[model samples]
Target: MKRVLNVPGIAYGGDYNPEQWPEEVWAEDMRLMREAGVTMVSVGIFSWALLEPAEGEYDFSRMDRILALLQENGIAADLATPTAAPPAWFFRAHPEALPVDRDGRRLSYGSRQTFCPSSPAYRRAALRITRALADRYADHPAVAMWHVHNEYGCHNAECYCDTSAAAFRVWLRNRYEDLAALNHAWGTTFWSQWYYDWDEILPPRATGAVPNPTHQLDWRRFCSDELLSLCTAERDVLREAAPSIPATTNFMVMQNFDALDYWRWAPELDVVSNDHYLMSTDPESEIDIALSGDLMRSLAGGPWLLMEHSTGAVNWQPVNRAKRPGELRRNALAHVARGADGIAYFQWRAAKAGAEQWHSAMLPHTGTDSQIWQDVVRLGADLQALSEVRGSTGTAEVAIVWDWNARWALELPSQPNGELRFQDLVRDWYEPLWRAGIAVDFVRPDADLSSYRLVLAPNLYLVDDTGAANLTAFARRGGTLAVGFHSGAVDENCHVRLGGYPGAFREALGVRSDELFPLLPEETVGLTGEVAPDATGTLWSERVRTEGAQVVASYTDGPLTGRPAVTRHTFGEGTTWYLATRPDPATLGSLLDRIRSEAGVAPVRTTPDGIEAVLRRGPDADYLFLIDHTGRGAEVSVSAAATELLTGKPAEDGSVTVPAGGVAVVREPRE
Candidate 1:
């Protein structure tokens, strides 16, 4: 059975700020919210000025009225602490609160998240504000949950302020226990960079022709940990005041803010909430959105909140373009299909003045007469009609391993292959599976792979002992594995594991890649072998050898021409596929098909080009979300007929034509 939140249907509404507008507009706001079926509204965010007018003095008169207005309207509140954007007075009084950039420049109030996360002044103020908010709203019926500090982090690395430098020294002491251990971990012996005292240590250099990438990476990791502690401080205060209400920090998807390792903080979060914004020029833009949804669902271990996403054009990106008709609903349905408990935009109403003035909102300056308003109302009513699919969770027999620490380490390694990126490899494999209508699990390396029929480890360059053990166990237990180029070469410390590439799993994979051949962007190598399957392109080629495995594909190269480019080995009852070269998308698709047949994995539905579909079944019902990702319409064919849950119409012939940006959620009588 799929897990559900307090509500049985999709939770609607968004970030509302009555503080941003006049009280005369409150009535219209309520009417429009009701029209959109907004049951919840997050409030008190970015209201530090209203909450705290002075150091010791506090004011909640405005907040009290806002809460009363919302409660009277039967709207729940996702209350924020107003600690995210502290007032200028606080920063002026305590200069330590200001953040210093990597370039050693102290930042002023140009944006939110400019406060030093490790600053004592900031922590003290954040605790006070959070405690006050929780205490005041503890018994309020409209209070839904506590939203701690908006977005939590803004990629602030390279803080050399005295406050941060002092904290960094303490952080290093705790991590390495001693100067000697720190030197060894940092490999300081290589550049004669040994540190005699803790004070000699410095934050990673900001700019130079040859910067220490490894130190910069470690510093980034340390900064992330420090910010997490800041969140923990506020969380503890809230927990003390109100034990029942859930607490969460909003995460920006794919942002370089150090907390990419949510597994470390998932325990603290009641529900993982993330802000999703898809920026792509591809017609299949919804795939990027869908991928973000899957990533969020995996992070929370269950259903997560669609905390913040743009309904259309975002003012922040280089290009801000409004979404076409039906695109908003299509994006919303993607989140719902991936097990999101609630869906909300960044703002209910557009800001007239601020950094996000031009960002897309439900209500623009012109008010409810706008097209966006109508779209919101239509989508809201449509969502209400399809409430039965509330708890449907994505089911998949294929799993992909994602490791943030490993990703960070690999990018920061002081070695060859500086261009190696984790997201590139993961996306290369994921898109092919997605196109094939194959649902995949974004799981941890330590996750139990027994349930999955097939597993993919693309650019899994760094694997600890436990991860290696888990992969080996899965292979021995009759699970098919697909690993790509530059995998299993190094451990977490960026050191080669000694025996050979892939260490313990060499026998299981039945292949050993001794050398890595870097290719130029325009370089071409035609792959010709049994497994090529017509895949061709210059997407980073490599040469490999097979011991016990059979050569499936070979690269036509200089000296290594006709060398194994792809190999397959039968291990236990299953098999392992290794790709030495980065195959083109077509070849990867063919490889995916082959693996699906070998593992007996099945797809839910298939379309010509534009349409994407997935079936999620709960204990008593099955829900299908179909999306059209192409510019032109595409026809979808399904096995079972269903009732159009969005429209309550009977679906016939197991087929439906979807126009671009069109979406359908159907519920059928389960067999």
Candidate 2:
């Protein structure tokens, strides 16, 4: 079964560190929480030191009170296992708990997420701690879910110590079994990199300003897998003790951590949750948050939660800017519009003093009467009043394949230009569809892509035979497939797949380029097209020849001026389109419009360009979320009159203007 969430109400509140405060303050925290209408609280996030103050001794005295306090206040608590950091005692007792740098330097812990993933000592201690916590709190009525660990990722992929090197060899052995296969996979023939023994394979060349991207990339993947193995270890222990308790790990939206193979990790999770920080109030910011919400929800096709977010401003970033008065509400509603089952802020109250002292919270240290406090109260009240909206599903027919393995392997190309980045390519292609109100899912390449009308894969640089065959079968069965430049050049093992770039997809894509023209950061190319009035686009330019294809756009400048920047080839009832250059937002917007028109893409509503809309279908009725990102009021036209859920006002057939950074959840009766 696809993973799914069942949210009965808008999830509220976030990380609460009662361990950081005096015992007397816990009561007031609960009292203020009642005023803000908080329904949940995440406890023991960074309490590893308190939970395991000594090596062999374990303590839950403090967490017992925290959980009891949450229950007393009638609030559910997201209980963490206090495993993000093993106390200094753990590292001191077992030096193996500390991570080793790729340069062979032993790392000393100063902050969280500092343990070495491959260390059996660390794993043993972590397992003991997780099991202890589960045994104590599994039956606690207030303990709703288990938050596994804080953002899981390697701070520095530099564990070349004996333990890591040995682990790396084991990982390679599992992947290729022997040195001969490893030699062939890594293409050791050219550089005499062939290994006669398993011990000869070193952890990708580490240390330096510009390290070997491919090796570093593999190391990153290995490290992520190592981390996943750690999570799975603890997960097994917890599931054994408390078979029914939900388990989740918080993720940062922009941060890349192969933590658990998302495809593998997601199914085991009860609800996928993320911590998102939106620095801008731009359309891009809204899209980023919405996409994150979609991804989290899509993980198991269940209701996901906003695990952590600031109610106002944040202090961790270089620039700490505060959210405007209405910005918080707009952001929260937008998450709901996508597929969020629950909504929560980063903290219940701001820190009196700490690294994140100034980060915004529902209740500032000033108590519960501030503007943010009042806004939280109003927002909570709104959520409580509209409990009927929970369990609503966003209707999206389009699903974009998002492969974490492809993201890891393909971007680590040995010879690709710096201009091409995996994440950036995804954003450039994804942003337009998002703004156009198209529901886009991030699917793995191996996932069933036949479900969607149009499947767009941007910069598919690493195309394997199985993946190529899947795409081939997808197109053969009448599915429109589109791909961008620098794609299908290499295999999973980092070797050029030989015959032509895009190896197996050469027949499907219908064109081949002899060489890639790398562009500098400042270099610009021109898009020659007569689509939109301001539709010309530019980025990197690629010279290409097409077979059984028609040119839609050509480069007007550069040596490859007349080459087809955009080409289309029709096969059977479906077609394949290749975009050889990066196009600006306007041009991409026009191109996506063409695909939408031709492929019959579905949109929730036909709103103005910058104003995005989504339809949430429920058993009784349908709801539409109209989000205005212009930061200025917008005149939005409605197909028919509908009642605004956020405000009890009636939205009519005539243009209903919406305020800047504002959101409206309107209920439209099914026709």
Candidate 3:
């Protein structure tokens, strides 16, 4: 289990498209892959058109040479099912397979994922190609892993077509079983929209007025399930061919793309994999990467694969800013530090001409003289040194609750705050924890929280009965619970909790709010309590009336001036706190630091402010990874002698000096 690739070390190559170049270039690519210490390459990600030139016509000559080439060079192939993009001929043959947007416009072919997930024609064609690929190369020695499909639901997540309408009706039948239950759950009596028969229901498509909130939420859930079902179908085909090879589709588990609920999708795959890219606009991309890696690790419950990342810049951003010198190494190693068993990129070589021509790769158009190429070689050697840490696991002192259903229900129309983003609120709490060098794990709302000392719920707008009870029980059982603003206001049906604003968590947090008062975009509120005197809040405020809670921070100025801005409630044996407003970073950091001390939760390692420290435990050794996010060097004190993986040198004086923007992984042998 030490080597996820079934080899000696971590997997290091990326998406390899041999069809993009000439035959002569294929040989050169293989030579370079060996020189760069590449272990495996994902093939045929978007090559459906090449594989099947027309409907029912197959061509494996190009792929045949490529697989043979990989076998000859000793590099493994991550063979992919080219179902993400069906051939143009297939789309032409079945025009109804194209997805229609919610606005009633049928999108034309030409882009990837043009087929509808619920279309029978599309499903049949997709499976046929998957069967062909699996039949041809299931037993090939060069194939190491069976990549089921590319990133699912990236472009065409939802469809309002007639085919999808039928599928939604079927899914509703299975969920509610009867029209009475469906009507009751949807609150159909409110607007006289009750359905006497299942045929009366339609997707919450473009309408004259705002559609029912419950209907809208169910539509999104159905869409996500449709895609998951397709992914499972394809994986079944591959499994029938070869069950030993692990099969997975890349999950987009980062910011801005929250289509598929990975919690529901993770169980369908043989192995969990994710594709993470840095935001060119965000100054703190490293923290975002760390959080994404942690989420992937938590989803897999152990070491997961970093399926795709960018070596420098991605071509899709409006302003594609390339990574500076040594940034790629820092990003890759940070993922490894957070439990990524392997590191890969979007592409192995730069495209000569395509939609992604501007995307950066390990072997850029500038050849082996570029900074990316040099760093790629160095990272390969670094991963080789870190091979011994493949199977180790990362631990967390704190857990953040994130539910895709709650996130989907929170962003519906007609809310207190229109500009409120789910991920932004979660990141606001996560940033401070990362800066303190605290290892954090993300879990679903219903996940068991007894293992973590502290749990934070940041804007969980929709709470099911099980989740609400779980949160309350966790607090009652002596775990510190911190609930953020606008949380616990609604149930699974998107219906308000009637009695109070923060309904589900009011008793647990010992606070109540009958109404929420949102501030203007430029408004600011000052706080007067344990935080710094100049501590301020923004975006939201609430008129708090405590039932059995003590005020921790009061609003000095705002709609709820001189009222409680934050509250602390003592539950059965633990303490619960409610955050009424989003505090600035420093103020939030101070408050969380104090709370951590009170909860007796400590970081993985104590280091300078911006340095990231993560510990991974193994049978014979414990690997400690120190990532210097700070621009300057950081000196970390070690309690015993250790071996630095990157430099192959022993750490002196039980101390390691991490260079600025550099990473050092120390392997400490167990006693």
Candidate 4:
């Protein structure tokens, strides 16, 4: 696969808005960029007003100077199309371009991503600006890649305006081909809501009760497609005007922004880039970051780009806490360890004015005298030293299935339980493996499972016949399969599969659920056999019966005491495990340990708590990244004799020490 950027080492630097600063500050900014070892920067983002002050009139003078200065400093440019936030004049000329919320309130145009995606006026303006930028910078020596737009559908994912309604009608007609088919698919006969004409249907607005499940689901899909259409429309412009430059749009996959289906969008873009922000409320933010990186890399099918991260606290979170002394470096290296070819932050300098003034940046308001600036310089040097680590891919023996459709289905109103969340189940399963030094890949349900020894799907609430068949085939081919609660209960249309629960994989799993016994938030159940003695289950439970499976663990005390809480069955050459409830960490770890042993899967290396060991393999060399996420030092067992790329010293005695909040990149020769 072609790499995103043609840089020799890991590309560094971030979004640079030189237009926000004074003219003299531009030269100093370049000097500081060079001093900090910045090699690339994303310019022209959120500069639509400056780029085009009026319709049919354009001004590239400021951007021209910025590009020239960056080239003079030997820095490559990731040029943006500057259409994310249209100027106030464009909206004034076309008031219908603004998006409307589900409550029928028209959103104002003071912020970014305020235009409706389905508006033809918006599309025309976006394409015009894209063509102008591509024509102006396509031949520039500083241009390396084209940033299509900044974070598509970030704020304005779904627009319930008239334009969107009309486009949605077209989308529905294209999908169903006829009104009768649409009625059957949507199950519109319920509640006497049958549609007689295509125009009678509308985007699911706020109703007294839950809207039709299929209607809401289809609307979500349609909104995502609309935004994707906007992206592809501009991408075609760049592809024609600048055939050589690759194009990409930043994805916000960190917080479950499932408006756009990334799996569908991944194939259309030249490279996959993601924007992630830390959840200060969650203590385990590092794990979330790793999860995002792995998911993005999987979407790209190789190394991806960290398009936007933060230098410190952000402006949007409820409580934006600044990073500790070494937290910033640790976070950046974490992404690099997990198949990131490039790392960039949101902004280069702290904004003097604007909505993000409080947001941290590489060059903070304190100038170069602060610890953040010093750390930024040090990180740049570190990235330069470890440039050879670029293009290496992380290896994993286990794959966890994460589906956006399933997540959306699970979050729909009127489910079995109100407290059940898709992310909670995923973290419950992923945390144990992550802490045990076992590498994992976040995969889609239909992704190739032949190379993996084990596959775990948590809360796979929505499954199609193809996905179910794929899982069955994986198990039959000797791959261990583990599935969690509420899986295989429904099809793609949110309609329950007939006959029994876990409908499609019932035979393969050798089990069936007769009833779902959801627990209250404070409820808990005890597990007795073949698990941790003190193990307890919470959040969910199910009354399960075995057809041919053997009971691995049973509930000791609860509503369904003495019932099977976990079961295993041998199918052909492989085994299938079912977890009927959310097990505590110790219990989950014990179960995973058994699965790992059964599949002969081993960790790359062993480390103490707060330290992570990840291996990235290339054609000629294997890179081992040891990161200490704690304030205290930790030790790791290095099985192979390898040279530490950062220190140029050989790791002897099969052991290495990683300082508090430090990283060690070791390269071992591969046969």
For every candidate structure, what is the RMSD over all alpha carbons to the true structure, in angstroms?
2.5, 2.7, 1.5, 1.3
Query: What digit string (tens of lDDT, one per residue) describes model 3 on residues 1-671?
Result: 12135645778999999898889999889888888889989999998899889887899999999999999999988899999998789877899999999898999988788889999999998899999999999899998888887899999999889999999999999999999998989999988899998888888889988899999999989999999999999988988888788887899999589898899998777678899999889998988998898899899888888999999989888899999877999999999888888888989999999789999998998999888999999999999889989979977979999999888888888888887889999999998888888889999989989899999998899998899999889989999999999998888988788788688998898888977888788788999988899999888999999989999899997568889988888999999999999888888888888877788889888998878898888888889999887679798887567988889788878988898889889988888
Model 1, 1-671: lDDT tens per residue?
22123543777888999898899989889887987898787898899878998875789998998888888988888888887788888988987678887677778975676788778888888888888888888888888788888776654534667777778889888887998887776777876778899888787656555545456556766777887888788877887787777888788755333454676766678768888876745555666776777777778765788888887788866777788877888888788887777888889999999989999888876777788888888878877876776666778899888887767776774545666677767878888788888887788778888789999887677777788778877987899988876677766555566755545467778987666676766666777876554555354555466778998878765556878878899987779888877788888778878977788888766567657777777777678787877767776665456677776666688766565667777776667
TM-scores for every predicted model: 0.94, 0.93, 0.98, 0.98
Order the candidates by lDDT, highest first — what do you get? 3, 4, 1, 2
Per-residue CA lDDT of model 2 for 381-452, tens digit only, reads: 767755667777766666666666566765554555654567678878788888778877767667787667
lDDT of model 3 at residue 222?
Answer: 95
Q: All models: lDDT? A: 0.76, 0.74, 0.89, 0.88
Instruction: Please identify which of the two predictions, 2 or 4, would achieve the higher lDDT against the true structure.
Output: 4
lDDT value, candidate 2, whole model = 0.74
Which sections of candidate 1 miss by over 4 Å? 1-8, 155-158, 207-214, 255-259, 280-283, 413-415, 502-505, 531-534, 537-539, 631-641, 652-661
Q: In model 4, what lDDT does residue 364 have?
A: 96
Report the C-alpha displacement of residue 44, candidate 3, in angstroms. 1.1
Worst 10 residues of 3 by lDDT: 1-10
Q: Between candidates 2 and 3, which one is better according to TM-score? A: 3
What lDDT does candidate 4 reach at residue 157? 92
CA deviation > 4 Å runs, candidate 4? 1-4, 639-641
